[model samples]
Target: MPGRTRPIDKLAAAAAKCTKEGSVYGKCIMADYNNVHKDKCITEFLKLKECYLTAYKKR
Candidate 1:
């Protein structure tokens, strides 16, 4: 369950399973809300994608 788990699944389950796992899960509540589309992750990812698109357009 430690390092043996798949990285893809581990990342998806990170925010989803925090509550069932421990109290530190509470910390992610606001962060998770602030990032609604697909968690803080997808929001940040979209921002990066936008930047990449803009740069690519210049070239």
Candidate 2:
């Protein structure tokens, strides 16, 4: 049997997908840890938040 996926893991996967898709802001925000918290990555942050909430509710 497979273990349950963590919320953080889901968020990481989403971020990885976003990074691969790329954005007008460039890959810096998606690829760099420091930039993850910056304004440029606000959209990505929201995506992660949504994933977290969904995962939390599922648990």
Give the poorly placed runs of model 2, Cα more than 4 Å off: 1-38
Off by over 4 Å in 1: 1-40
Question: Which residue pairs of candidate 2 clash?
Answer: none
Cα lDDT tens digits for candidate 1, 15-53? 343333333333444455655554445444454445544
Model 2 per-residue lDDT at 52: 51
lDDT of candidates 1 onward, in order: 0.47, 0.56
Candidate 1: Cα lDDT at 56: 42
**Which is the leading candidate under TM-score?**
2
Which tens-of-lDDT digit does each residue in 1-59 have in candidate 2?
Answer: 27988767766655555443345335546477564553767675566556555555554
Question: Could you tell me how far off, in angstroms, the CA of residue 15 lies in candidate 2 after the best superposition?
Answer: 12
Candidate with the greatest lDDT versus the true structure:
2
- What is the clash tally of candidate 2? 0
Q: What's the TM for model 2?
A: 0.38
